[model samples]
Target: MAGGVSNEEVGGKLWIMWSQGVLVSVVQSTNQFITVNMTVNNRCVCISFVYAKCLQMDRRELWNSLSSGIVDSQPWIVVGDFNVIRNDQERRGGRPRPFSAMEAFNKFIDTAGLSELRFEGNQFSWCNNQQGSARRWARLDRTLTSVECITMFPEAYMQYLPRTTSDHAPILIKLEAESVSYGYPAFKFHQTWVTHDSFLDCVANAWEDGIADHGMARLARKLKKLKQILQIWNREVFGNTGQNIQHLEDRLSRLEIKLQEGNNDEDEQDYLVAKSELDLWQDREEIRLQQQAKQTWLKK
Candidate 1:
């Protein structure tokens, strides 16, 4: 972690963590946010994690700090729970969000040259969790990146994972590069397949289809049948994971361009749907890579 809590009175703090291979150096830190330069594979990028104060007056300090401090040309990314929304559409079941608040937030993005990254999963990342009439939902958490950052990793996107114990859902920012293709080998079970909603159903169906034998031979036959079924399922459900991600990235880029020119509700909805689908596949990709690394480590 690169930052710490400065004030005991404040309810929230900011921190940034990375794996062993990545080099991280703190550039600046405050109660509101932590700025750092991260180097991976000899490429450096600046990232800031923010947890803004609930009050608009207090948040102005964070806005000013980001707008004035991050003046460099490096690929820059800003993410976290901002505690503010950019527009009316971002909130539901609450009193209409104040226009002044939205205006100020927009002003900061414009000043900083940051674009809200297209995202997948739930539309709202936070909720009051109240019942029907009293409930409130808002997109308080988000990922924003500079034009340079987008150019550097055009397939990058943000994913709002389903909320569990917390009122706020966890968000993931994926910075994807072009993938290298390796020829397919023997059948191997991917750990990520278990996370899919339909995986169990597919497994059960494949297992119960009725093999003729009654001993070790029967089990062997069933296993072979299941493998074949799983391979087909993987292709139909996920396709080529890397290629699918690239395709979605292209679609999102076109939608974003159309959105910037003007507001189109249809385009906005399509972008959200595509983002959600991309995130699902990206999550699977992350799990598969982690498992592969563990296997390689064990072999060595």
Candidate 2:
């Protein structure tokens, strides 16, 4: 159920621990990773906990072992600190990552037939707690799964908890059944919407058309119209705040890579634009979270 390397090992060690509720049997254990077969709720799943080597050359072994060793039809989930990133967007404030490194990591994922699980909380899991420009952040820790694993855990998600002592934030993964939804939800206006320059124009346009009624009847019709228009406007302009931030971050990463290869005025401008847009979305997301917290507190 548990295994790890001693201090004498060159690279870091890995350990797999589980509760009595679940049955676990180690299939393979190495300095880089630990693979186990786990059964819970009468269902079996394969999991790998990895602590990859810092050196790219050394990590190649880890990649090769996992890709070849774990070839099976069982639901599989691989999780841990890979010590490498799949793309430029997974890092910030660090020296530009080598393209070859990213390509290799991505290739490993593709070859292994694994998909990175979507996560919540901080974008980066690891951070150098240095001051000013010395600070660096990267998403070295993550969860990946095979198609069968996704089918088995359709409502699964990972969350990066706030760090207390370590450079890396703790990652918590939840596997639960999907909840059924009923009825249309109420339309709640987000406070961030008012910050956009087109917000006023959008509202004005929605309200400009008059309903052929008076008093309460006219007010009710106008309110419904406004809500419908705002919903569409939100979709077109703002969209999903987190997803928009991610899009901008990815664009900025690509632009940064281009800029690193060779300085280009166009790419530089685009990077700045993407950064600006990303900042705006991040701020909006913060405000939205704050509002949600307040609402939750009020309900409690």
Supply every candidate's count of residue pairs whose N, Cα or C atoms clash at under 3 angstroms: 0, 0
**Across residues 1-300, which tens digit of lDDT does each residue of candidate 1 receive?**
333323224444664667667788878777888888888899899988888998989888889988877757889999988999999888776688778988999999998899989988767788674533465678899999999999999999998765534678789888995588899888878998888899999999999998899999999999999999999999998778888877876676565445544557788689778878878777888999999889978997
| Colliding pairs, model 1 | none
Instruction: Supply the global lDDT for candidate 1.
Output: 0.81
TM-score for each candidate, following the candidate numbering: 0.60, 0.57
Q: Write the per-residue lDDT of candidate 2 for residues 24-87, one digit (tens) a residue.
A: 8877777888888888899998988888888889888889989887656889999999999888
Off by over 4 Å in 1: 1-12, 177-300
Cα error, candidate 1, residue 196 (Å): 20
Candidate number of the best lDDT: 1
